[model samples]
Target: MKYLIILSLIIGLSCSERTLLEDYVFDDNDISVVKHEILSSTVNQGYTLHKLNLTSLKWFNELLTNRPIWWHHVYVSVPDNLDSTRPIFYYIDDGRNNETESPSETAKLLSEFSTKCKCITVIQRQIPNQPIIFTADPKSKLRIEDDIIASTFGLFFFNRTLFPNNTYNNVPLLFPMTKAVKRGFDETVKFLKSKNVNFTEKFVVSGASKRGWTSWLITAVDQRVIATMPIVFDLLNWQKNLHIQFKSLGGGYTYATYDYFLVGLTAKLDTKEIREILKLVDPLFYLEKYSGRKFLLFSATEDQFFLPENTKAWWQDLSIQTNNQIYIKRLANVDHYLNQQSKLQIVSDIKVFMDLMHKETSSTRTLPILKWYFENNILFGATRIKLSNLGEFDSYTVTSYSAKTKDKTKIDFRVNYLLDKSFVDSNISWIEAPLIQSKKSDLAAVNEHVYRKLRILSIFNYVGFYLDVNLKLKDSNETLSISTDLNIIPEYYPIGDCYNEECLGKLV
Candidate 1:
């Protein structure tokens, strides 16, 4: 019945001289677009469905070149039982299209141990060239999450060419792209509402690293989302960073959000108009408006690219300015990409927080292990896994794994051991080898002393996990190292403890 009404409503929507569908899609060619690969999955939430899709480079090239394009795939994990109300979890990937999958021991373990009511998934691909925008070609190739437009929790991809000249500066900034992505996101939300999709409840926005910066701006741009979580948040003055990187003037002829170009007054208009536009587009200048939203930011305190002080200042102001609560959890001695245990902790923590906000009951019953298979062969940030306890020792190892996608490698330690300080022993033979990007790296360890106290370090490159470490002792003098893996299992929490589903309104 609701679907019938929604279809009818969509039919009645007045079309502009150029309809949105027509503006983006020209004909069957657009609709029939194919990619190097496409991957998908489905999950059931009470009131909504959730889905994920991974695309290929062909899809990205079409969009980058200003061709009429269709998003490569859609991920639809909707609710099986419509009457019941449960919050939805949505995830999207940013970068060039390349569908690839790898077997991950850590991701699999985390999924297996994660809470049943909550969903953890990914849609990833190898994105080459970091979506550059140069003076010769100033265009945004980033795509919004067109797949799950009907979802209440709309987690879309936010891509921007802040420093158009720096191809390596994939680190996201929070200014211009926010407005464009928010505009599209709000339209999607309006569409869902017209379809009678009940989104009046809590809404959550989340992203990892660059996407995390996008998530931050989304929460600020739209105060409607109840909560936000940006894993390994990275935000810097992109234009300045680019200027420093390429040793030239930053930005380009125009600014772009994803693959679309938006007119910038600096290039196309006067200086006064540029200042006027800056008032609206600058995220830092517009921070006061986001006071009602709650945020849970998870980042490695050790992450170098994203400064802890900067994030702390942002979090502090948000808390002081906002009427709602702010939860800041900084994982000690971790990097931009968390270790296996920390990753599990991230999923568990996020689930608990969302479940509480949504008023959903967490089950005490045992849940089957979920294997989160994300296939995108790109790694962002540092690949070294830093341990909380072994911060003093820069522990490195030669762990072996296979490629999940063309852009990613899978690492499996294949060891059954829990990480502990006692396992550190001198019998461990060690040699440090230079890291390689594509093929297996050298197994020789240069620093023999570092291995005695070292446990493991999983080398990663964007798309997913790449390598694992195995410690074997050949002599009695050598000590064994501890190993740990994360699991995704159901969590048990008390139900119906509070009837304050309207806590958000109370904050207002």
Candidate 2:
């Protein structure tokens, strides 16, 4: 059954189980290497950057557009020590077909990471074949990024007829996007083998925004991905997170999420089809498959589209918590971009964490461990946070941002000036949090406030502050970060029948 399949393949997979993601299979023809060629190769920052053109397959023929042939701009960087046994870092990104095709952006971050990890790095672009004009209406165009995703949601989720002429309906934009990544990897391996290059076949995948969502989805289906770092796309447990946006943003999602709003997706969120769609896309259902995988649930504190508190919805729901390593890395005063005012962005340290991931199995460099200081409020939540392996760290610090406001009943952190880096610099500061000696021995306590014990049935701030615990590696400038759970002071919906919505509450 490895024949070419359409995006509508998902409709045939409507069963409500982990098998929703587990059972997805790409056709051999979908990932078949139609062509893969190295367009150019150059040395930059001590790494070889190879610009490659990969034409994987004819995704949807005579359906959405006349151009069914998928074209991908892939860049592979070779580290100093290229071994077939070492893991590879694959970053899935989105770009326009006509944009400046340069690998400088990936070089900026991955060069240092390549040196540290000594692994092959790859960046695949033009995820959805951008700047695409609708087949029916030539004027109706779609650009790269979330807008493409939103429109795709319109067609597949609601089965909207944007193009009146086409008989094709419910063709998902999700399937081909994932195929591009898997095929890119397949082609990369093919080209490498042609050049007598070696790869481990193991992958550590990372991507931002829509690509980040794809990263999670691809990992769900592809066991090749042993580690996944999905950046800034934190809306996991899709059904609940979507509704929480309404709760956190005062009964409406942020304007930045207008993409979802414009396509009438927000209206169908409560529908049965959308709920079924969430099962296929949400990474939560695929947690059991991630037992031995390493995960970095990367987040941005000032993200306009997603709330910081959204993580609470799914973090505790991760039944595989003990079976996997899930790190919550949050940056303060940064928005969806995760970069602001040349500020020391926390993502700069991601290279170190990734380096640690490679070493987890092969080298002596081990990742840090964290613990919850459960005194008496184990049921309410841990009162304090603890960082173990103190002797291995050079130093550490904690910072927090309060989502609370003057009204204890309301918590609104998405102010208008989130984009103005200077505004955050002057007004809202994720100030250094004070560390206290833990009640438990051999643990370093990292908490913002002078600990407050939660009594049974006692309500705290409508939404309290969340802490980011960062620890520096021994004798190096590199650092790793993990955050305490979002302090969502859950509230009841005035219009809806929802009740007792804990921070980790599940509507689905």
Candidate 3:
């Protein structure tokens, strides 16, 4: 027994030492500074555009840097007659097949807009492997290769020779793409500053789909971006979205699904580890950091990659949490590739959103509020009651009633004005428990149903009164009474007491 204990201790110590060494080695090399060189310049339609290439050298674990990673950039100047003080719109282009669209295309798109702004579209092509050949057509099938895997999952598990991360194997795959984009953007900004460009301090970052996802991350990490517009990108809430996808696909598809960018390498990892990995790359986790920034999310109702419901849910939550800082627009009868009408609508929306941002007026306004309270005695000899609310509201009252007596019960929960989603353990509200019965009676036999209704009013809105009611039984087996009056009063009530006839008459 003594020998076994000693051997176990030695093995445990060795494992701990190995883990510590791995973590230390992984973070050995800090992110390297990037260098940029203007490769070429051209003049088109009264504007001068320059093509710049960026290079950065950094070591990843055991992966030796054979050559510096390269990223390409194209900067288009504002038209000579336009206002130079206008904000710059930086578009992060998705480098597909190592090709970038003509800078003139963007210039033409924004020609109709009144805002005079310079445009810089960045295309990051300097992934570790050049000319990434996908064995399967990405549109038809999911392929697990270095480029896609690295961009989607971060730099965790790829060939050491290609990525060189011998120290930190747990790194997320999306880091490489993020680092490359950030380096390219920073270098472009430096180059523009050196050229003495007279542009506004405001920077708008825009992208679609995969690039859209990157745009969110960039805005979250980089303070330079004041406004962001991401189109046809899902919330990427891994816990909810992944579970929905896995179950919807009959449990056959996972992160390995072609549509998911082949992040299936995480399948072997435990739930906690997977969450940690997602926390590193998933944009949803970082969105809360963008409190002051303007957000415009564009999604198609029938998006093939991201579900529309999930997108709306995320937008709703963001709108509530951020107090209406984010705006979402969903077009009907459109897929991932939006139609011409949807595209035009998006452009119009962008113009309006930008105009709103440029205005000096304060945009903060109270949001529509909805509160709900639920009470029931269903568990083993215990009753659980829950109260929750959404949106910006001033105050709320939860009134409970007994179905048998058809009268207001002693349970009257009230809380002062506050803006929050959770009502659990709220400092303002009070919870009242029912009196204990005699020990002679069987607790299981004393099952009763409870009904609750929540009356919520916003600080500003008066015409729209919100109310919610719920009916629940103490035991799951007990049938609810059909005669339960679940009707909720939707009349506008004043802030103070309206128990008297004169006060009640004043309520419209």
Best by lDDT: 2
What value of lDDT does candidate 1 attain over all alpha carbons?
Answer: 0.34
Compared to the true structure, candidate 2 yields what TM-score? 0.79
**Candidate 1 lDDT tens digits, 1-508:** 9999998787666321332222222222222332322232334223232222322212223333332232322232233333225443433235443334442443333233323434422222111213333222444433333111101011112223432443212122222223323333333344345446553333466667655766665665454565677787634333222222111111221111112112221221223432332333234444654565656667554453443334323444555766324554555446566787777666666655554455422432111111111122222212233222111122334332221111112111111111242221112111233332211232222221111111122122111122233222222222112211111011111111111221111000
Runs of candidate 2 exceeding 4 Å displacement: 1-25, 31-33, 104-107, 137-139, 158-170, 319-324, 340-348, 361-365, 373-382, 389-395, 406-410, 415-429, 436-463, 489-508
Clash count per candidate:
55, 1, 14
* Tens-place lDDT digits, model 3, residues 42-95: 666656656666664343432322222434444544454545555566665544
In angstroms, give how far residue 457 of model 2 lies from its true place.
20
- Report the C-alpha displacement of residue 454, candidate 2, in angstroms: 12
Question: How well does each candidate superpose onto the true structure, as a TM-score?
Answer: 0.41, 0.79, 0.55
lDDT at position 389, candidate 1 = 18
lDDT of each: 0.34, 0.63, 0.45
Q: After TM-score superposition, what is the CA distance of residue 337 in candidate 2 from its true location, in Å?
A: 1.6
Q: Determine which window of 10 residues in candidate 3 has minimal summed lDDT.
A: 403-412
Better of 2 and 3 by lDDT: 2
Show model 3 residue runs off by greater than 4 Å. Answer: 1-33, 56-68, 81-85, 96-130, 133-147, 150-171, 247-256, 259-270, 361-508
